[model samples]
Target: MNATAGHDAYANSLCRQRVAALLRVPILAVALGACSGPGADPSAAPESTAYSRPRPVTLVGYDDDAMEPFLTRDGRVLLFNNSNDPAAQTDLHWAERVDDTTFAWRGRLQGVNTDSLEGVPSTDNQGQLYFVSPREYASTRATVYRGRLHDGRVESLQRLDSLASSGLAMVVFDAEVSADGQWLALSEGRFVGAGAPITADLLIARRQGAEFQRLPASSHWLAAINTGALEYAACWSNDRRTLLFTRAGDSSNGGAPSIWITHRGSDDQPFQPPLRLSRLDGFVEAPALSPDERLLYYHRRDGQRWRIYVAER
Candidate 1:
């Protein structure tokens, strides 16, 4: 429409074309037709770019404050936080997925959520748990911690001190590890006046032995993901080639939070421009997908409380 907007759109198109040429692999089809073959999700539309309408999930025993749900690889288990309110009892809880819109509460995760703020539960297919905590209750050096989640317990608890917040004004808000344990994705936020993050960026780290380190090359690789917005909740797809993250829209423009997707052809290639997920709206964030990438999970504000919701192809 305007000169500036048109020029920006043209520049972005060229950038995507350049990356596509270097990758030499077919970019992910935005349509759901790829999954329309035999033994696929029959409910998936062969021609649509959107998913089914999201529905609120009922965590039977959990309170009216559930959010940030991480559905297990098998779609049987769910790990989430009750609430993040400082005045309330904030902790991580687990549930058994009873069906498409229901889960049986399994209670607080033992050994991890005691006397502190623990939230943002993320797990790879190997059952490794990655999450965030301010840890004001402990003399910890980091805000992110890792453990092995199994049978309603988090064992081998250890803070990833190496990836801790680098400054007093910043903290790791959300993070996840690759299924192969070779990569780590995190959202480090800088706080200003309010409690919410004033600025945030997604960073990628390469794993070496027991520790993960950020490299200079990751900035180039993730250049398209860490744009000029409130980006957080970084997640790696099952193949580790596709990335899912949330971009908070500007309150000035009446924009709401949106989940975006970007993909690379290989481990070394840069991600293409992020494409906002279709038909997802409202105050939704923390996008999580099943191992097959069929079911999408996120949380939305319902009046004064937050609740987990799921959308399927």
Candidate 2:
């Protein structure tokens, strides 16, 4: 291989290793757009121009380092992890939303969460549960899991063997599946070292048959969303035309992970440049919207620990 290509290869290899090591840690917080085929309905979002200031979420029956809160399309079910602490062997948990900002913890999700890292819970209307876990991280490395979520139990758990696989060694730490189950937005990053910590971007995959696959056409639109920064925790709006993700340490947020958003007129168009959610700030990541798009939910660092918070329109 040429010298430049060889150097690039070496860096990629190191990236995978450091990323794996850091995957279990709580510090490094962790996709872009759908291509043609999905239709758009601008009416999904009301005439609200801004979201409310971030506030602590009153999570009943649970209080720990919350991360990656995925609310179902009906805004009834909530799936998340109790803590990001690897020492705790974090597992996915479920809850039922009692109101806009309160969720009553149901308990641990059976059949999933093992004695390893498991969080970043996501699901679609079809009851397919998707999450990231190091349960098999030693063999799979960068992995995203797929399973059936039913009756508060997860079954037939399996890694996304290909589409959201760590093909390039970049881990699929966070994911968001549209309610319609047509599009999956993944936020990925590779840890180079402590100095740099992480370099991440977003990627979108289209659903084909029973599986999800990357659309080559995503390259054009993804550019507008990636932006060469630590972008992760992708959330798709009800219409699938609007996307919200967290940008870690952008110029606007002073190196803190803050929420940002981008939108397209339709599925055929590329996304516009992302704008930071100026009203929301601080070490916050994982942007999730309510079914009606009236409320936005995310997790933020509260002192030394983390907690889930929300912002309403």
Best-performing candidate as measured by TM-score? 2
C-alpha lDDT (0 to 100) for residue 294 of candidate 2: 85
- Enumerate residue pairs that collide in model 1: none
The list of candidate 1 runs beyond 4 A from truth reads: 1-50, 136-141, 192-198, 251-253
Local accuracy of candidate 1 as per-residue lDDT tens digits, 202-294: 888887888888767888988876754567777788788888777663331124456777889988899987766656666667888877788
TM-scores for all candidates?
0.79, 0.82
In model 2, pairs of residues that clash are 31-186, 31-187, 31-202, 31-203, 32-202, 32-203, 249-255
For candidate 2, write residues 172-219 as lDDT tens digits: 777788888888887666543333334677888888877778777776
Mark the regions of model 2 whose C-alpha exceeds 4 Å error after superposition: 1-22, 25-49, 164-168, 191-198
Per model, how many backbone clashes are there? 0, 7
Taking all chains together, the TM-score of candidate 2 against the true structure is 0.82
Poorest 10 consecutive residues by lDDT, candidate 2 = 31-40
lDDT against the true structure, each candidate:
0.67, 0.68
Angstrom error of the Cα, residue 174, model 1: value is 0.6
